[model samples]
Target: MNLFRAASLVSFLTLLSRITGLVREQMVAAMFGASAVTDAFNVAFRLPNLLRRLFAEGAFSQAFIPLFAATRARDGDAATRDLLDAVASVLVAVLLAVSILGVVFAPVLLWLMASGLQAEDQALWMTRVMFPYILLMSLVALAAGVLNTWKKFVVPAATPVLLNLSMIACAALLAPWFRRHGIEPIYAMAVGVMIGGVLQLAVQLPALWRLGMVPRLHLTPGGLRRSWHHPGVRHVLRQMAPAILGVSVAQISLLINTQLASHVGPGAVSWLTYADRLMEFPTALLGVALGVVLLPQLSAARAKNELGQYSQLLDWGLRLVLLFSLPCAVALLLFGEPLVAVLYHYGAFRPVDVAETVVSLQGYGVGLLGLVAIKVLAPGFYAQQNLRTPVKIAVAVLVLTQLLNIYTVPRFGQAGLALSIGIAALCNAGLLLTGLLRGGLYQPQPGWGLLVLRIVIAALLLAGALYWMQHHWSWLTLPKGQRVAIVSGCLAASVGLYFAALALLGLPWWRMLRRAAL
Candidate 1:
């Protein structure tokens, strides 16, 4: 398989998801601004997301995919199908119980997540409404894992676009309808979220069905018990034990940060969230795209005992990480205010909000390389079924993050929170890379020094260009269309300049495609 081609497919689809996602956020910020109700929605929405990461994408995917790949390799289609059924049965039962508990404990969850929220009742109501989204997303994650293992990457990659479109529709249309009906307009966002979840899950089914990999869910008490005892199910649970610890450490950090942001002020959470939406564009386009493509491939290589292939994959992914993420980090740090102004300076969103969000965006940009690098590095341990190492590293990073927050938050406010996370990410990525090298799991390829030099030179040129563009425009004072036009032109020019500089510096631009042919 061409890894570059696969990663490119995921990246292109993810770009669509991120574009629609920005439009969704733009609508939300325009209609609501960084108000109390928007904070409520951010807090309420995070409830299921925290759990979804823990249960579905985080621990579950880390544990399930490697084992699933290995099982399919060692056994046959029949055995793999039975394993899927067993896993799906247990997963469904667990999700149902959790969703119910979440709804019943909505108030407690909201308070725990954001006790300082001014609109507690509104948050509680939205929390209850959106809590069950975890159920839908978990199933979607399951289908994604299956489809990805089969190298059917398109459907899962495209699934997020549906959610983004759903929210975009709700924010544009449903929000106004709610206002007319004397209902809270922000409540429509929660409704849109659930709608999106359903659509996301619905699309995954047909994809799975086409591959004949649809899991036959068993809900009966006897059937559930039998599934719980299945060997494959037990194996997955065992893997998840450490995987959960690893994932929980990261989620717990987010939980703490959310709690902290709530205390900062009304718009604090929204500011950080808006900045996160922008950060996620490049992170998803490059980092997530590579991670999704690499994990299954790494697992397959490991299962076959192809040690050389495993290391080569890591090397390729890391090089791509440095080559692409450097220019993005530079752009985010240097050009954030203009990006924020053009995308969000509308309706209720004010000039003040733009300034506040720019601080957080730059903080996030400070560690963009590390943040993206982790997406590639952690899978090195996960593909080897060594979840404990990353868990141990995460525990230390968690402590370090909070310590930084203690020093920074009181001094710099919510931007400090973002800065702490970014700094911690750099440390986390460094430790992971060190572990891989010391264990001889990865050997750096030759010419890395030259590669780094060329990338640095290219990034410097890109940074200079962005700095010039940022100063030349009075982005906040400009009309919307003019602002959009200039920002779009600057982005195009910046990308072109970065790649042209890399080419002139003797970097092999075609090597990414050519290496994949091997």
Candidate 2:
């Protein structure tokens, strides 16, 4: 697959997913507001979501994809199939045990994660309802990795659409039923989450099957033993062990922020979650999708011993991230209040909620480049089958992140939690870049100095225009339709000027794209 073409497809699909995600968040904000109930839901979701990252996104992908792609490239189809069967079967048994334990120990987990939660019992109950989502989502992650390695991006990318649609349907339909039955409606959201997980896993099955790579589970005793201990599985196991540490350390930072937010106030967790949902828009659309496409290609490049191509792909990723992400961060930093107001200042969501969300949104915006940069750079380490470097970096960043939160959270509340995340992201990107360059693993492309200058100049022009526009409009006072129209226009103007600045500065837009393809 053409790297940029594949990246564009993933980006478009992911953009749809994120848009649906925004609708889902808007539904949550409208129904529950930044209340203790929303706090309960956010805390409940974070634990399982963190685990999902560990098994599915973080450790597993970092470890699994490079190895899986290499197996496909060098070891042939039969061996690749054997690896999948072993990994999938063992993964099922492990996750089943872990999910059961999670449900049984929900309160303990909740206390560890958010001991300061004001509505501790409510959060605990919600945590139990959502703990099983980790099991479901982990399986979904494995299925997704398999499909991605096979270049079947459609099913895996489209699966999130089902998840978002499920959540939206449940929030709109089932929550009201639960409320009518005198049950807390968030319970319905938890149920929606489980259903979504099932669909996410199930929807990707046909894709795997078409590739003839679906691993069937053996239910009998001897069969189970055989599937768990394939010789090829040992390499995956070794890589995964260190990857778990890296994933855990990374999650520790988020958990620290969530825990700190709990201590700050009743609605702090909800505010942070809401702000984070918006902050994730660009990260999801550009950083994540680009990373997904780059991983298998990079792994393939490494298997072929193409170091020059490896450096070029890595450089391409960084260039695209900076080119797109910098302007996005600036836009969010400047227009965050209006953006928050337009999207979420409705129903149970009040002016104060918007104000709180805007603070955290801008905080997160500051780190957008770091977040996007990490998506590509960490893959540089992973693609070379070097997991230890990222583990060390993640550990160091986790420490620095919590320390910053210690000083910042008390001063800035939810915004501090958000800001600390940005600081940690920047630190991670810096460390990873340093390690890559110093290790002599990656070579920088030419024109980086000029590229950085162009992006900065364009982003500054966009920021200035946005700041000026902000003074001319009363975002809160305008009618909702008018507010959207005016903000949309401002966004259009800012985007145009950003590109125009880049062009007028003698950096033709196509030059960046052409360089990335090198």
Candidate 3:
């Protein structure tokens, strides 16, 4: 497929998954509120998710895909099949071992990540109940990498929808049972996660089967030992080690936030979780969609020594992210409270919960551009097999996060944690962009500066218009009206204002749209 077609497919599927996820989060907020149970669930869910990113999505894909692509290109179908079987064999054994360890030491792991939670036996119990999801999801990750290599982006991208669907079902149907029975609803959520992982893995099976790449059980090493000796695999490993570490730095920021939130108050962790869900809507829809679709194309181009195509593709990806993300960031900053109120204003979630969550969401929204930039740029380094730079930068950002957490948490509470993370993301993105420029891998195309200027102007105008509407409509004063009027109005005005400003600035929204169409 062409680059635009590939990106469109990925983006459309990701947008669907993100919308379902929003609905799921809304259900969660309504049922659980910003409470201790929600906090426990967040910690439990994060543990598996962090590992999923670190090993499954981040390191494994970075290391596996380039080699997989090479194998597909040079060695043909047999070689690819053998490689898949061998890798699958090793992966199952490794994931099983890790899962056993996690189940056995669930409490200890929870304590280390959220030390303050050690005092709360309830949190520990919920964590143990949810810990087995790590194994199921690791397997799912491997399957996803295999699918991505096959250029079957649709299934893997759509798999996340299963997770949200499962959670929503549990929250809407099963949560009441737990509540009436006096059992923690968090346990139900944990069970939903395990089921979600299973479904995620299962959904990809049909695609794999159609590709004739279904991996069979093989205790023997098969091509696995050869993969260890393959020069391409070795190169991938070399790049992946540092990339994994770098990715972990982002996860570390979340872990630290959770740990600190655990100490802040009863629902601080939940508040942060709620805010992050809002932030992730745009990040996943635009940033992750671009990164996942672009990386493989970039890697293939780099392999073929087509530096110009690689650079152009990266540039296009960045432009796409900026076009969508900047305006979304602006809207988030202006209407965070109204958005939070609309999504999470029911059940046990109250106006106070809305207030705290909005503060965190705005803090996070401030760094949304940087967060998306990191997603778009890191893949450039990974595609080039240079992971150490990102790792070093990540470590530096981690140190900054710690320092800020220490200084800010005492005064600003949950908002401080969010701000620290946002600042660190900006730092990481800046370093990545600098490195890309220094390596001469990125150059501004003609009119690039003018395009960026137009984007900035449009975003500012949209923000201003939203601000005016919110004040004149008294959006904050009318709680019920604020939910519908503020969110819908801000979104509508931002869309109109941004596009109108872009037109006024002579940026060809139509031409660009036509190019995307073509």
Candidate 4:
């Protein structure tokens, strides 16, 4: 499949996953609300997720996918499997060691993430119980990278539904069981996480076996020695180390946000996580799904020395991301409160929680464009086998984000935490784009200025419409059924009106989007 078609398929699956994820979040919020227990679960879950993003999605994909694609294109299956086996062997060995240490020093990790919270021990205990999720998810990411390389997009894209289902089931079923036994339901949630991680890995294994590319674990020293010394494996290791440092710096800022929010008060961390999750709905749907589809295409383009196609592909990805991400961000800013209230206000969630969450959600919405840009831009560097540039930028972004937090947190509280991330994301995206242009690796297509203007105009109109509708209805005071019905109508109208505005401005996407199919 071409980039657009492949991306659309991935996006559709991701939309499904994100919808399920929202349901999962709704269940969790209803059960635990944004209290200390939920806050602890967020920290524990985030510890693994942070590493998963850094290693699985960041370092591993940056290093592994290009080489794997090239190997498959040139040397065929045997050679590709050799590279896969070698990488898998080393990955398992290292992640196992890290997981052991994480579990052993779980308190240290918690102390780092939640030192200011008076009940740090609660989150710390959960972190220990859930720490091994890192090991399970690392393998899952490796499997996903392999599947995407083979053009098996649907399975990898749909894998997260398993996680959402696992969490939802545990929250609904096992939470009560744990409560009956005088245990915090959060512990059941943690156990659900480990089980979900395992299920995610299991689903992908059969696909690999079918492709004749399932990696055989070789944990013995001789096995590790043989794998690590290969020239291809060594090159992968070299790229991965720098790439890890690059993404690790950005993740550090998030952990810092967690720590700072922990100090702010109860539910601050939960608030930040909730707001971030809502933002992820669009980021995952567009930027992330496109990133997943683009890398293999980019890698193949570079391998064939098709620089023009590479530039065109990058330009298309960026334009599409900006076109969709901007309006979505605006919608979040315009409708955050009602969205949060309808989705989460129940059981233990109070009015104040919704109000604070809306503030942070808007803050995060400001950086949505930047966050999406980085997904497409970073891969531009990675596919070219240049990891150092992003690492440098990431380090700078890390400092910038922390400095912003230092200034913002004292006055803004949870909103400050979210704002720091948004500002840093914008800065990071700008630097990445600058480096790409200066390096001459990505040449901007003509008509960018005009295209951007049309998007801006349409977004402004859409925002205005949404703002008017938000005030027109007292959404929160209505019955639950009425609230859902009105919100759905408003959302549909917002999207339809935005597209109509774009069409009126002579930027009809239906025709243009199909051209991107090639």
Best by lDDT: 1
Query: Where does candidate 2 stray beyond 4 Å?
Result: 514-518
The pairs that clash in candidate 3 are none
- TM-scores of all models? 0.99, 0.97, 0.93, 0.98
Candidate 1 lDDT over 200-241, as tens digits, reads 999998888887899998889999999999999998999999
Number of clashes in every candidate structure?
A: 0, 0, 0, 0
lDDT of 2 by residue, 102-200 (tens): 999988888888888877777888788788888778778888888888888877787888888998999999999999999888777878887888888
**Once superposed on the true structure, which residue ranges of model 4 sit more than 4 Å away at CA?**
515-518
Candidate number of the best TM-score: 1
lDDT comparing candidate 1 with the true structure = 0.93
What is residue 189's positional error in candidate 4, in angstroms?
Answer: 0.7
Candidate 1 regions with alpha-carbon error over 4 angstroms: none
The candidate 2 region of ten consecutive residues with least summed lDDT is 509-518
Best of the two (2, 3) by lDDT = 2
Deviation of model 1 at 206, angstroms: 1.2
* Lowest-sum lDDT 10-residue window in model 4: 509-518
**Could you tell me the TM-score of candidate 3?**
0.93
- lDDT for 4 (candidate 3): 64
